[model samples]
Target: MKLLMAAGIALSLACISAAEAPSNYETYYGGVRVDSDPRLLNHYNRVLAYCDREASLPQRGSPYPYDTWHILALRSCLYRYSFVDRGVHSYPANWFWGHVFEQ
Candidate 1:
């Protein structure tokens, strides 16, 4: 019975650690999970802020004129920022699975 209890405790700990582990995307995209690099993380946050500001700005031309362009530009900037910070060229292929399986 003692052995079984110890095993159960170990298993629970393992599950907790696994759940807390950073996802591949967080590590890959802009190093958000990187606690050691505050500078890079701050820059990533600044970029996101800038993107939000730009997206919220009103355009003067046609209705929704800059919507497509803004989205594309923001996406490009984010991808470039992530690549620069994390040195990862591609998004995690398993990102979807990670979220689905976690819950």
Candidate 2:
């Protein structure tokens, strides 16, 4: 009985961790679905990194309020690559716009 209980606990723990694993794309800015192409993925990652750096800075006396600056910056960067918005906003499902790499 003790062994069975231990196994059950371990299994539950494993499931919990798996469920909490991070997705390949960022969840904060709606949902972005990047293509499997290496170039697109690299570009997406670079945009994310750049946006992250931009977001970390203080936004004192900025025209955009709160997190607007970050969102605008992200949109601007992603737009350069011709990312399309799917118009879904469910979040964690089909939310806001989707970004894809078009060659």
Instruction: Give me the candidate number with maximum TM-score.
Output: 2
- Candidate 2: stretches off by over 4 Å: 1-33, 58-66, 90-103
lDDT of 2 at 81: 48
How close to the true structure is residue 100 of candidate 1, measured as C-alpha lDDT? 83
Q: How many pairs of residues collide in each model?
A: 0, 3
lDDT by residue (tens digit), candidate 1, 14-100: 332111111222445444554446765566567766654554554511224235444444544555556232222222334556568
TM-score of each: 0.33, 0.36
Per-residue lDDT of candidate 2, residues 1-103 (tens digit): 9999999776543332111112333333445555445665676677656655654456522234244444444444445544533333313234212443221
lDDT of each: 0.45, 0.45
Give the Å error, residue 20, model 2.
17
Off by over 4 Å in 1: 1-35, 57-76, 83-103
